[model samples]
Target: MSRWFRVGALASVAFVLVVLGAALRPLVLPEAHTAASILNAVEIGFAQDMAAHHQQALIMVQRLDRGVDPTVLRLAQQLSDAQRIEIGTMLGWLRLADASPLSAHPMAWMHTDAATSQHHSNTSHANSDAMPGMATTAELDALAAARGHNAETLFLQLMFRHHQGGLAMARVADELLTSGPVKETARSMFQSQSQEAGVISVLLTQLGGQAPH
Candidate 1:
């Protein structure tokens, strides 16, 4: 995609962020949601899917620290800590709404056709599996075995793709989810991950690595 296209996309996201922020006055209060006493499909799906997505990121970050350059290690730690905290937040949402942590159909929350949902559910990167940026089992195995400069480059490559995929989902959540907390959280992901992906792209080139295939 062109840079202008990307900018326009994020601009739309920012508009949604502003809309959601206005919505927060009424929506942020847990009491308001508690009175509603039920979670909608979008809310349930986002929390469940995103929590699993965050878990895979934590697993990937753990491998980025050892035998890597200081810069890469710092980024790895940053990702680890941020993702861990976000995971807690997502789980808290699930608990607050008394929803199950796992859903039977993974990307059904994404509102795609039945064929797409089945495809996502069967994708093996995770159990609740339907997110674009998750590493496959073989890729994770390669990540585990890598070290030194190789590890740094591979990690940057993988994480760049990961964040891009994650941004897509976050933007979708911003559009689809009604809950204030969920929208705020998704907006944060959209902004943070967009910035992080740019950084990762630079780092990958600095390390003489190719962009994600």
Candidate 2:
């Protein structure tokens, strides 16, 4: 009986040890590696570029705010708020990545000469205006002069183009950059803006308008 009691006690102690080991395994072991860091890098780049792009859109919307169309005014306000918040978030990612938000060459990370060439070609002609998705001095002036539904229509049209330009930039970021906060931000932007673009499309239809083909 004494020997049996000792054996049972040892068995109970071993069982407790096993349970303790299992409980502590997670704390002692390293987590599984993942692409989270890589995604973060993409996010940072996406944020920076998208912020700059949104800035242009904001400027255009501000010019149209003086018009009398309530719908346009409301939409402009929404765009301004959403983009401003997103810009701040992107800037934060830059800080996290130790990257400068104000790089000398904007959109340099894109590495696509085609985009740059297109921007330049559009502005090459003496009378040609700023690139598409960019507001020119004359176009802004015209938008400022307009009022009522015409102003609303114009604002929607310009904003639609601006969003499309941003979408393209986001796509490039998603494809190219790897690692860090930039990648994560890029993925987020890709998902979020894609959805937002759809919503914008719906709104355009409701307003008796359509996004450029």
Candidate 3:
């Protein structure tokens, strides 16, 4: 990661985020304000929680060593770009709906859905700190301190587990919202994350690292 390459990468990321944000603004605004119906609790809650979930993903990508394998860097770039756009989209919905961008109760939204309740029964007492598959503070610290292959392996393992948790939330949202932009978004998230997780698994195996339990 020469200084020039680092600068170029940052610029590219910024350009993508700006372009995607502008393109998505119309899609998020129309239903939010022009539609006759209001956004339901499920929709609002999902946006809030999932946005926060995606924020952590950006952090994981940032903590990765820039000197790692090019393949790993490319994957990180893809995930970061996609999730940054999604975070913007989710925040747009929250702004239009007059909802908080952060969920005060985190996964508490899942409790309203019976299916989610049954599926996450073990997490009845979960909080933001207990969100499934979130890397602990110490874990993140370790990742930041790691270098080269070590950082790459740890990132893949952490991100793989993070996707699993977020995918669970998206699945619940998809099932709970019968028809809405939120449901559609959740379904898309599930599909995209599932594919990314698979690729991550293969990469982790190649790096001789097991996905974190």
Candidate 4:
């Protein structure tokens, strides 16, 4: 009799819990299973193109094969590290959104149309450059041929301009991307890159070099 009573009590508790779960399922399920927001063109474009942009930077920074001032070396190392991490972050967002990592036309998302594109200050990005502050193959070749101070100077100029261009992209991303992770990453980039640009400016002056026109 005692065993039967215990079994009956356990069954009754399980039945009540199941009933309670069914009653609350409607209230709890939707949010629990909510889908991630789809990443729009701007989000996808920024991720794809910016990853390429940073990859170029990584390439140039690595080209400083010869020794440089401690400061220059440290700056290049730090910038490259940050760029690598951010590239990874962008790629991660793209993966989550199930989007491609490369945009064939690159800046297609930055253009509304020819006339409308002119209204955008950064529309030069639509040209053959693919991105602002991107060093051409010729320029990268020049940088690779340089050594010591010349290489350091050229790298400084290139990276400073690159960061400036990246800041423009980050501003656009912060404005246009709806994804929280995308915007948050852009905002953080805006903050850090601005500060790094200031450091670059100081370094350039200390090196007796000026930004490329």
Best by lDDT: 3
Residue ranges of candidate 4 with Cα displaced over 4 Å: 1-37, 113-129
Name every residue pair that clashes in candidate 1. none
**Per-residue C-alpha lDDT of model 3 across residues 133-163, encoded as one tens digit per residue:** 6777899999999999899999999999899
Candidate 2 vs. true structure, TM-score: 0.62
Q: Would you estimate the TM-scores of all the predictions?
A: 0.74, 0.62, 0.78, 0.76
Residue 20 C-alpha lDDT in model 4: 100
lDDT for model 4: 0.81
Residue 200 alpha-carbon offset, candidate 3, angstroms: 0.1
Cα shift from native, residue 77, model 4 (Å): 0.5
By the lDDT metric, which is better: model 1 or model 3? 3
For model 2, what is the alpha-carbon lDDT of residue 138? 81
Off by over 4 Å in 3: 1-37, 121-129
Record all residue pairs in model 3 with backbone atoms less than 3 Å apart, i.e. clashing: none
C-alpha local distance difference test of each model:
0.79, 0.66, 0.85, 0.81
| Two-way lDDT contest, 2 vs 4, winner | 4
Window of ten residues with lowest summed lDDT in model 4: 114-123
lDDT of 3: 0.85
lDDT, residue 194, model 2 = 74
Model 4 vs. true fold: TM? 0.76
The model with the greater TM-score, 1 or 3, is 3
lDDT of 4 by residue, 83-115 (tens): 999999889988988888888777666555442
